[model samples]
Target: MITTNRPTGPVRAVEILLAGARMQVLLVRSHPLIPVVTVVQPVVFFLVVTARHPATADRADLLFAVLLTSLWGGTLWTAGGILRRDMADGTLGRNLVSASDPRLVVIGKCLGSCLLVLALLACTGGTIAVVTGIHVPLAALPWLVAGLVFVALSGTALGYLLSALFVLVRHPVQLTSALVFPVYILGGLLIPTSALPAPLAALARGISLYWAQRLLSSAVSGDGATLPALLVLGALTIAYFLVGNVFFVRVVHRARVKGTIDLG
Candidate 1:
């Protein structure tokens, strides 16, 4: 008699995620500065701005929001950076040639990024809350954790899309960073939308981070807007993931066609 082993859906997903984790570690370990820089840069800025505006009691709160947004942005940036570096160094092409699904590779790297984001959030959020006295209740824990996880997944999807684009353009850092930073600003992280110019405020309302921030605020404040904000965030995360996956698949195909996908 012969025996065979089978995997369930969740298990398969876990395997894929592990693959992504390994890829992220292997590709990015040499450049630990990315997260280190991310951890420090925002703290310094937050300190400086809060010191100058002592009247803003919410400064630390707003700064925490901004850092949260940057967690997603930084995850995307890290994924794209690793993809670009791998492509340039011929690592991605070689990996693609393996029997493993490119999607698995993508998923694994994203898992790694998600871990980083979670760690950063815990460390940074704890520090700010302690220093600034931003009280988060256990009642808000569910929504807060859910929102962060969704944000991380969305960030991972966005990273895959940007990574594909970076491969195509070969120079996307400035363009991607420019496109991403405003999302944080609009997310009510730095300043409230009411404070932004009319057009910019409108654009901010259109972003997923806007909903995410609202959800987080509601969770923290136990406000009436929590449900609606959660609904919007859920929808946005699904949409972004779908669109990003489609874009990544297309770009991978294009890369294969151009013969730019072979190992160097």
Candidate 2:
């Protein structure tokens, strides 16, 4: 009998996700600081913000809002970090040259980031709820989880996009933390994009995190425009993934043509 390859689709996707999940887990094990910061950073920031203002009694609740962005921040750096780490360790080029889809591999890595986000969210959310009495509606809990997952997918797409960009540059200053931090601030995670200057707010809407944060806020508060938020989040998630995929493909192709991937 002749050997044959199985068809790839959902099976492949699940496999990639599992692989990505494991990779994310291993990284957390290797570097314990990530989860610690994921759980602690927002609370710390919230404290600093509240100490000065003091009128935002609902600040704890608002601080909880940062979890989604925190998750994406983790995903952003982790996805790129994984790729860059692989490149540094001499595995990225080999994997890129392999027959398996590198996009899927990258997606899988992002899935790993999502797993960490889930854990951190649980710990941080639960702790804050117990300590501050601000809690998500029991009914709306599922929506919040869904919102986080969607945002993670979007962030992963962005991470993959940045990783591709990382290969194009030759120096650390050439990187885009400039845009990353601003996106985190303006993405309506740190503050409502509406609170930002109008022109800057409009620019922030270009990122999926804005919609994701809006959906999460609605889910947690059981108020606001849930339907519109969900619709926009879904659309933005798809757009981010597709755009990232195309960009990664093009960047990798260029790097290969230019013999630059090995330099990563």
Candidate 3:
């Protein structure tokens, strides 16, 4: 009976992440409808929203913000769903006791899910651009890409956190569905964060989504504080990842003691 809490080294970590990516590939191959569910639905939602309120320079920031929301929302669903599915399918118990850190299980899910989310975001943005002719200059593409990557990292960390949390619930998939819009609504995914009530706004700042939206929105608007925004985004990403790992560690410990890894 080995009871240990040692850090997972870089090599092992990468292996775990790659394993998660491979798992995702198998999932996509098995379920051809994943792309439709993750990508097309968001694009449709974007189209509907834009129709209701078109983008102009005054509110053009919403364009990328909404795209970020699509990826963010997708990450939440995919990560939580994957984790819950693994639990139900009996894989989580094996991984929890295997060589990998239990946290890596969540991290792996996030990495694979983020890849899909990126593709989904790109599809949504490209489709919107084709019809609306809203284009970012070539020079801006790098900045835009960086902003999107930052958002993805933050979102991935968020998904990892949710993966840890949703494991404790009966209907974990609904957990993500419940949070998808509400977090955005409060995080200023469509509107500015300042419009939120003071307490809500403060709470928003603590979450990675708020920082991600702020950074991406700044990049979209060409306000040119992207370096600082990137810094903040990185900080928030690290914070979320660390906090999520802590939560996962606690849950894993509890599950091991109670022998409920498969039960959840």
Candidate 4:
């Protein structure tokens, strides 16, 4: 691990975040799977789905679903393993001792992952547009952009929370693989919550991606109240951050007590 002077206060936090972001960028460059999941998989899924439902090819709403699905997948596979990668690389203990707040590092990594995924989403969207001829109204472009930003934020928060939980698991790969489709179904990214049973529909309301999809749908359709979805999405993001911080604190405490950060 690289070493540097331990700065104090907010500057330290910012530095830690930048470091994590840089680390994430480096990881993405080295790891071929990040792009495969974030870009290739989504593009292929979009093409396959559209081909199966030829009538829905031009629908703007489907584009939003595909984009959100990509975001969730990228977050789950990339940002979700932040701490696990650190532990495996033998840097988690060093990071815990060196950083004032390790959560900031996770946040930074999530932010970096989201940014990269967003760029890949743009490429995916462009490719989908060229192939399917899907179009968004000029007026709706602003809302769509705002919706994308919120989607990234919501994904980042969820990634941070998941990372904290994943670090404690013995087999995080199985757990991570298990999470993908359930979140897709629950989040309404590819499925409509209205089509789900009453209990599942109600449960979908708790997932941040559900609100994100609602917000994106509203943005694409220019129907429904965007404010409510935006507010709920923001609230959920804050809640995830708070809950993730608590989880990180507990994980740190446990690691310290056990004299090792590698719980897995």
Candidate 5:
């Protein structure tokens, strides 16, 4: 039987988180499809977009859009089913019975995924730059850096929420795939929200990615106030975490009472 005597302290928590992050990074490295999804696919998309819209090839905003799309894809494939991976590997039960909060492990895994995606983003950026000779103004660098930071944070939060929610669904892979294009459209990652119908555009505003795209656009253009978009993105991220926490608590309780971590 698993014991609930695991050490409880800030140090212990940090250790667990670091361990989880390491494990996640290893898993991502081992997974063949993950690299393709996070890097190659985005590069291919960038190529196609530049080919079709040669006029926009030099625009930094185009690069930002591709990066945001890639980040969303990474969030779906890497962090979306994190708990399911733990359950399949027979660690979820142990984590549940441990005294330390399992959510910390999840958070660490998400952070690890974000780090991996960031590395992949750099590769994607390099490839795109080489292929298209697109150049970003030095003046926009600070804004771009800030936008990237928020993108990572928002993606991590969304991944955490999805990881918790996906555990409740019987077919998480199906759900994950189904989620891809809708968010692309709704988040305005590829197309401007202005092109979307008014009602759809209004609904898209509820998604953090919508605001994230707005921030990135401003970042690339070096125009418009980024504060409003940043504030909305931050608010939506916090909301996702709060709701996800509630779901995680309920799911963990149910798992404990039922004596099974395979809630799906």
Candidate 6:
């Protein structure tokens, strides 16, 4: 008989992550409405808003591009909300009993959400390019991708923090929608941070969304590229993951204490 030792270390983490990701895929496939609300709404908004000012082609193009980029926040929020709902309903608890880390499960779902966002962005961006007749700077595409990934991670962390609260509170979806809009607008999707009032502008500059948008904007805009934008985004990405990890651990501890995490 042949015997093999159990996996350990980073290799085990990767195995757990992949397994958790497959589970996430199954969950997403079962929930069709999530894609409609989470993915389609952003695309619809980009098309409608940009169409209003068709004559200002360049302005509309830039606005549409930024809008597409901002969809990461909504995607992450929706994914985290769904995960929290599952956790509260005890499905996640059942998964926790398996040989998988809860943190890895979270990571897997976040990655799956990010992949969905990327697919949506590609589809929407392609459609916009065709419908609006604007040519994207092909050379800047790599940087744009990098910025999107960074923003998605930060936004996912923020969503985790919010989901932790929603698990406990179970507030109305409309209220959550109302709460999320400012984060988008103030994130420089609608108005540039430099154009906002001084205090709000300063506050916006400190946010992960702000830095993410700035990095993306500088990459594709006619304005000169700025190294500082990349630096800011990198810093914000690190900060968000750290904060999110702390918040998630605390929430998990609380859930355990309250007996909220149990297999039904």
TM-score of each: 0.85, 0.87, 0.83, 0.89, 0.89, 0.81
Question: Would you list the rank order by TM-score, best first?
Answer: 4, 5, 2, 1, 3, 6
Lowest lDDT 10-residue stretch of candidate 1 = 57-66
Clashing pairs in 2: 20-108
Counting clashing residue pairs in each candidate, in order, gives 4, 1, 0, 0, 0, 0
Residue-by-residue lDDT tens digits, candidate 4, 1-264: 999786788887888788887778778755787778767888787777777778763456677778778788888888888888888888788767762677787799988887888777878787777776766678877877887788777777888888888887778999999998998887776778888988988888888887877787777677877779999999999999888888788779878787645743
What are the RMSD figures for all models against the true structure?
A: 2.7, 2.6, 4.7, 3.7, 3.8, 3.2
lDDT of 5 at 200: 88
Against the true structure, candidate 6 reaches a TM-score of: 0.81
Ten consecutive residues with minimal summed lDDT in candidate 3? Answer: 55-64
| Model 6 Cα lDDT, one tens digit per residue, 1-264 | 998898898999988767755665566654665556445765676666666756664653364445544464445455557556675567766655566677777766665665565566657666766776666688878877777677666655665555554555545365566666676656666566777787777777767766766677677774665357778877877776676677667667665676654334
TM-score for candidate 5, residues paired by index: 0.89
TM-score of 2: 0.87
TM-score of decoy 4: 0.89
Candidate 5 per-residue lDDT over residues 68-186, each given as its tens digit: 78888888889888888888888888777777788988988887897788778867786776776766678767866787787777877887899988887778889999999988888
Question: Candidate 3's residue-wise lDDT over 44-76, tens digit each?
Answer: 766667777764543345556666666666676
Cα lDDT of model 2 by residue, 171-221, tens digit: 633464555577777777667767789888888767776777677777777
Residue 26, candidate 2: Cα error in Å is: 0.9
Candidate 3 versus truth, CA RMSD in Å, comes to 4.7
Error of 6 at 138 (Å): 3.0
Q: Candidates' lDDT values, in order?
A: 0.69, 0.69, 0.70, 0.79, 0.79, 0.63
lDDT measured at residue 70 in model 5 versus the true structure, 0 to 100:
81
